[model samples]
Target: MSMDFKIENVLSMNGGQTDSSYARNSCYQEISLRILQPYLEESIGQMKMVPCGRFCIADLGCAAGPNTLHVAQIICRAVQKKYKALGIGMPDLQVFFSDLPCNDFNLLFQSLPLSVPPDGRLQACHYFAAGVAGSFHNRLFPRSSLHFIHSSFSLHWLSRVPPEVENQMSSSWNGDRVYISKEGRVEVAEAYLRQFQEDLKSFLRARAEEVVEGGWMFLFFSGRAGACPRQQGGSGAVGDILELAFKDMVCEGVIERATRDSFNLPFFSPSALEVRELVEEDGSFLVKKMEFLSMDTEMKIQSDVDFGRMVAKQFRAILEVLIASYFGEHVVESLFQRFAERASQNASVLYNSLRQGGGILAIIERACTP
Candidate 1:
């Protein structure tokens, strides 16, 4: 409902293929992509009704870089492979990579693969990729134009800080905190919950208009399983880590305490029931699969990674864009420095919190009519 939260205001990921950047920190995104790969293949492969012509696919909130297009290619290849198996010429394909305007499109295009020589492959020369700069909270494509829509690790963000929480005089203001903690005010928590519901519904409604009847969408983001919004006992959750660092900064006179109190992150983590309710209420999507899984449970522990640094890279990539925009560029360096230090200080606790972190994977189909 509120458009004050412009996409350009947020920060983009660490650009380029640098080893210490988001390219390396984004392992969890890869893991999520794999989890949804089979569904992409099977659903698109088996679609008997998709019109035989240019097929449109959009990856909403596709942050800049190789990985974004890389995942889309995986889905694209699966469809082409299926068409080849059926002894038919492949349809023309156009992919829309939509994200915030601040996203590094130049860097992403630089990373795009030039081309695979046409060895008489199924979809050779049939695929075209382009970046569409905008928020997924609004319509990004023409009506009934998309065959598949995919978004990962993006939807939990609210469009803006709720006005109730933003009002200086309101009791709901998230003072001295950047998020709704276990000890947060009830009104603060309720404002956040209300904002998420509104934003998610708007997203689904817009996508419903853009996607064709029976078209599929796969959504993966951080979500909790139980009835509560906050995951109990996970004190090392990124929100907690950030808050801890903020507290330390306050005590040392680096940043004024009121500054931290006034700044609440424009984000929330919904429970499974909450996600389901929003989808059902939208009335234009049929819920197919709703799963809440632990992010680290599926991982095969890699011996090489320094766990604390790995986690810090991801948090910085995600929050840096907004933090730098609101807090100032000078604070960015020291903030993440402190974030990594805090994470390393309690390695066991931090790793356990990550292991216990919740992720949601939901597959929904657009109804022909609302």
Candidate 2:
């Protein structure tokens, strides 16, 4: 770990607030899954050739929420239906829901479905859900253990911010900026890029060891459709624009100027090409499908209601913990309140940027020959 690194227990999502559970804001994730439903079915289809006596599936980065089980159920159903169609006895199923250690495992465990109906062609499937506490940047299971791995709305988060950018003592500090954006200087962007490269390699290497040959991995996360993620503003890439909210608070005296300068999110938005290049070089997994999924941004906003608040809550559920760890909970709430106001006023910019934002869906298979 870098001496300047501040990633760990400090960063976590809001633990399912009454109004802002991950479930509510995860519509983008849900839709991302649905869009890749066909590819998911295809990945499950691989079991026909690979022996699956005990199928193990993992939903990596599964925050505690109403939507986490939905992914697990999909995996269970797919595996069950595949086995049933072949007139073979289904294998025992183990589903791992993984996330950072501070995540609300209690909430996630509490929300699991008591049962799941058959999917595709099975009668019924029984799945045992295990809450895995660890960062996906490191290994969490035995080698060749996982069969189908799925992660959504995650993985864009680097295990830590770039040491160069955060270590102010060094000449590589990102200055006052907290994330990659137009505001970030060249070195700042370079620091983020370096961190992303290192973290991504670790993640791919770790997953490569755990997944058996012919096992499939499905990853869905926000990404820039453009070639350069460093420049900011990609489809579904509203991450950078959120900095405006921070600026608003700073100017309004709601937060200290130094506070905003020190805060930097560990998030990184990778372009499809970046991921492709790394996976290709990893020599562990073969890319089966990689494409961008568009989000639904055409919803008609009621003139009376604040549309910005609606969107801010979604991000708040995912980001509040990280922000609160540094600035405290009170500050977190105040910041978002101001964010909601600004976001609503700039809704037109958001809507226009929607076309530039989209989710990357990648289906990869552990090389059978490897």
Q: Which candidate is the best by TM-score?
A: 2
- Residues 1-370, model 1: lDDT tens digits: 1235453467467656665466666877777666667766776676644437777889888887657877778778876776678877668777888888877778777777646447733335346778898888888888898988888878887788887776669988776777777777778778888988999988998998998888888888777766765453332167777888888888988878777776777777777688888898888988888877666644444432355566677778777768777767888878877887787776676677667776677788887673
Q: Cα deviation of 257 in candidate 1 (Å)?
A: 2.0
- How good is model 2 by TM-score? 0.89
Model 1 residue pairs with clashes: 11-321, 176-261
Task: Show pairs that collide, candidate 2.
Answer: 234-356, 235-356, 235-357, 235-358, 236-357, 236-358
**Candidate 2 at 329: error in angstroms?**
1.5
User: Per-residue alpha-carbon lDDT of model 2 for 179-263, expressed as tens digits?
Assistant: 7766556676677767778888999899988998888888987776677556655422355546777887888888887767777
lDDT of each: 0.74, 0.74
Task: Quickly count the clashes in candidate 2.
Answer: 6
